[model samples]
Target: MTIKKWFKSGSPWIWLNAGAIAISMIMVVGLLSLILVRGFSHFWPAPIVETTLTQPDGRQVQLLGELSRSQTLPAQVMREAGVDIPSDIDLVTRHLIKQGNRDVWGRDFVWYPETGMDEWRYPKEAMRLERREWGDFYGYPVRLKEEGRTVAEGEKLWPELQQRVDRANELFDEIRGIERGDIGAVNHRMERVRLEERRLDMDRRAGRIDRASMEEATVELEARRAELADEYAVLQQRLDQLYQDVRRDTLVGRVMDGREVEIPVGQIIRAVQPNDMSVVSKVGLYVAQFWDFLSGYPREANTEGGILPAIFGTVTMVFVMSIIVSPFGVLAAIYLREYARQGPLLRVIRISVYNLAGVPSIVFGVFGLGFFVYFVGGAVDQQFFPAALPSPTFGTPGLLWAALTLALLTLPVVIVATEEGLARIPSTIRHGSLALGATKAETLWKVVVPLATPAMMTGLILAIARAAGEVAPLMLVGVVKLAPTLPIDGHFPFIHLERKIMHLGFHIYDVGFQSPNVEAAQPLVYATAMTLVILIVMLNLTAISIRNRLREKYRSESD
Candidate 1:
């Protein structure tokens, strides 16, 4: 039991390993707990407090906001910082009030000492408005207005406002569908027509165009343009109608400053009086907010709303990358482990692949940009899409280039994993298959590959886990702060690999570090981080499940 004796007996090593594992588990649990508490709680309806903030000059200022956070600091530190600390206690309590009427208060959050606040109470009538801009508005509903005229007043206005919001949301959805879908498709088609015309013009300039053929093409192009113009005019008229409907309703609410402001109903995302809300209502609101976070597109420079695009982009890129990396990785591993003559050259190649795994991912991004985009993509554009020249379709940083770069970045891990898996298979199996008149290629493809699927999947899982969380490489390759259009749409060649994409990893970095509204973006950062973790876990779990299923099937066959 002596320390040296225990160490000699390997008990010390066992204890050390246990301690390391315990510490790691604790760290992980703690991190997850912090994220969950901070992230999930953000959706809960917090009561709005109507209070009088007693200023040092003996003047009371009316304030309305949600009580967000509280902290206790040493009184000595408070006093040193020139805060009016009470003499009775060694600690001074302060609370961060989310005074969210940013336009009125000129600030989203404010801190007040306990002693500096008087008659603060959670009022049932106090409202919190989630606006499209200027952040949240803290006020009381004075009335509801439609087209500058009073529609509903007092308590009756609440139900009326809700109805209008529903109507506005529906109209908004319609407008969005028209703008992003129909109009977008029209724009794409129009662009194609323009490109076609350009191509025709180039041919004419080269004296390759027949006069009759050119005239026919011009007529066709003009006819298409006229049709598109008519369609656009009709769409514009419908959009105007929708806009009028969406903008007609307004809420006349009295802010904390006693100023009655008219907030356009179209600008409001949600309005809720949290203090008046029942438990059931609160739960409903919470679910609604959470769902919005999950499904909604981001706004306000990605500080507000959901991250659907980022999620979609991340998953799609990873999926595409997996498809690309799997075969190449497996083939390379096969060549090295099964077929390649082992010598100095083979050893050098193996070492190179391993070293490539250690290369910084951003380097791969640069390589992708230079090689895949500028060189190969430029060649593609020149050879195939010459009309779209200078506009740079595949020649630009895009989803395909990003996926390919990530595939290259993660290929080594896959190769190493596959090699290990291939090496583990008994040579007798291969020999037996060959002995039974099975060709080497057939045995390798059917028997060897099947058994090694789980290992391949494991490598894929690793690759995906790394690729999904990567932001640096993506920034250079394809990721943007916000991508207005998704890579996938109803356009020709349905999956637009040339489109730039939003990625959760990049979104987190942008909101957390690059955002101007740091305080407001903090919660979003935590929530996004938590979401990214969940997404990665889900993807890994899916791959792991497939791997497990394959392993089980093969194991049973072997038995």
Candidate 2:
């Protein structure tokens, strides 16, 4: 076709649209691939390299760690950074070595020019310890000691060390169970008793109860407190025993500098000789590490370990928000579409709803903080929990407040979707129902709503996708860097909506920006970002699946 004819026929625009879509799809896939490679590769066991680095001053130093990253730097840039780079060379190769004995060297990574590095070797006996604190340790195992006595050395030390490490981990689990389960329960009960006693005292002061009754209630609460204290004591005793057992064994490791350092068995999460591991062994270790990253609780300022709590909190908050927003949004849409008169006032209200959807999410967070927390929550605390005044149970940032705020923020989307769905139903159907002697309410309830279910789910899917990745609003409403306990637990009422929660979105922000160790935290940032994307996709897919099924069901019924 001629150019003018093509323009008039919109052929150019069609091609242009296709090109744009193709580019967008490519960009999305590329971004996801980058995240997957950078994030997932971190779990694989990389062989540790021993090298001698010659300094600009002609001093040689031993280096031991995994090769993290390599980059080409301009000679001028290297010179500007005070590194000795020859002017003859235009580009200098630099390597970022993850020399991960952070506790010994005070740094986890260091950049070295490739020119100064030589004598690279991989020692089979080289060890890497993933620890509970101070990051990873790179060294060679010298001996295994039990309670300061040498139990094994030389070739036999490796097997003995592995066995004792396993035993230490088992004891660690026992200690954690005692502390978080039995002891936690006792502490919770004791706090309840204390609150009850305070309530009784307040009632007495207000003359709401007789003095004798108040005294009896106080005595009973005190007895309950004493019983809980005894229970805690027993649990504490068991935890102490576990701690001793876990710490009884130690590994003497010789670091790159040839200094022997003793590490407690309890502090080591995993021990591996990467150089000696076969491909199969490395793959197995990768799977275990990846699983732990998904299921373990984060430690070390959220720079290490798994994000199970964040995952649970994100899903729980989204689930709760969906439940709260659905009925309210659907009902509002029904009223506006089926009941409200089409006039200037209705048009204005509709315009306002659309505007609300465009409002900044941070504004909604402020509103939630003021109206929901300070006003509603404060009132609840006053009326229902008068004795807990200063503490302000509900009058604080918590899981319920965050969910409610998100529900409010996404309500307009749901309303718009549902209204559009309702409008799509032919007017003839309503007239037919009316002619059949069905009331307006019956026709709307039985016929209109069922057919519109899919659209409602579409809105829910959008809401979940947006809310799951939202960080700013959640930060002000409820999300915390580290929540000591989950909102849901084996406590009275089961789900404590008043508790603060960890969210994957917030965790990403914290780890990426707020971490003290920038280089070490970089990979974790990508991993967490990837995790958030995956979570949002999963939630959206679930909603999409439900919507499709509902649409199919209604279509079949109509046929």
Candidate 3:
């Protein structure tokens, strides 16, 4: 077939492969875009309750909450339900669940957000709250009643008032039943008093007034006193229970009474702004900065989204790795290309370099831990920086060690790329340069290296992209989840190379899973992840641009 005919026939397969690749790229781009947009959007201004509450100590605190009411959900709801709970404010939740009131369970603040109900993870015995300090710091908001007003009116009293009604009913039931037991006991005692009175009357009527009957009358009176004491004890118990129920706020009981009172659940009061422009400006800036950092590419902790540290670490490590590996790789490539005889030994060396590339990265991580960090770095630090001692100064995982390890790991790629670029140069060009009074070393430095730097840079860029995103190895070496201090700081020389640093890659893993507050940490996780992907793209783009420029510079020489 003719060349044009062959080109036309191959177009279908080319289009198919290109279309598949395009769709995949679109999908990847779309997912990353969504994560970036949503993660940043969370930091935008959200509605919050604004109030300045006065504490018992006469100090005002600015508090923020999602609910509208100052009278937050009352903790006394437990007591109102006749639940014999402990005094621990913390333990109050368990008994609250035990009461099984739909309003308390469904609408209470404690566990509503996490568990969607009042069910508590901790047992009542394990929970404890300081009693004396438990005022507004503890219960539903009960604003101080005015001089004239005693009962809080409307929805505010609904929950607590219902509690009182329940208390009254319980007390009424016990009081009404007093005749069944205590009243009977009282009656028995009263009978003894009557008998004593009758005996005394009978004796007097007989004109004898017997001493035995008078003594019996006194004994009968004592029996009546004992019966009356028992009835009083029973009545007192009922009154105490009534008093306990009355103290619980009315909101809980009222809510249970089928009242649609908007009981404050997660109520928090914050300071209200007095419409000042300066305050508005500060608020605006805070919101804008928050969104800006979250939306951008990954950086160091001290920068926007803290992606700068990642970028600096990644580029710095790669440059160091290339510096360490390039000379060694280029030397080995040169020996194979120009000096080495085509023997079995040379072929074996070539095969070994290729095999090294295929070794699992984790194996390198293990080797770095045992050989490079502990053995080499420990010896260096032991001899030099002893003040930062015992903590494995150079003997630990760090930028220097990561650079060296990756250099060894990616050496074969540099070797292969350099050798190929060398081979591509026509033998005639080398001969002509040497013929013009240039030695082999001079020709290499002046001619070959300049021509091949672009391809070598390509190999280095690939090595960098892989190293920057590495995590499993970094964790083993030195990427701590929480470093007490940043690796870079302002002290004398400024960059604290000895200090452990935060990495964007590690930050994503730590914040997403290991953080104390998962709800709050999730946005940060997505923001970091989005930032990292963007960074990798940027590094690769730089490498591509360099390659294009060199290809253009050298294209004319070949023709």
- Please tell me which predicted candidate would have the highest lDDT against the true structure: 2
Better of 1 and 2 by lDDT: 2
Count of clashes, each model: 0, 0, 21
Q: Estimate the lDDT of model 3.
A: 0.56
User: What are the per-residue Cα lDDT tens digits for candidate 1 across 1-559?
Assistant: 6877877999878989999999999999999999888988888888888878786668787878888789998989878888766678697788888988777778798878777778778888889888888999988899998888998997699999988888888898999999999899889889989999999999999999999999999999999999998999999999999998899998988988799988999988898999999999999999999999989999877888899999999999999999999999999999998789989999999999999999998899889989998999999999988898888888889999999999999999999999999878888989999999999999999889888888999899999999999988888888899999989887678999999999999999999999877878999988998899999999999999999999999989977
**Model 3 over residues 371-450: C-alpha lDDT tens digits?**
87889888988776444455566878876676677777888888888888888878787888999999999988788877
Ten-residue segment with the worst summed lDDT in candidate 3? Answer: 126-135
How does model 1 score by TM-score? 0.96
Please give the distance, in angstroms, between residue 243's alpha carbon in candidate 1 and its true position after superposition: 0.9
* lDDT (0 to 1) per candidate: 0.90, 0.91, 0.56
The best candidate by TM-score is 2
| Cα error, candidate 2, residue 351 (Å) | 0.9
By TM-score, the better pick of 1 and 2 is 2
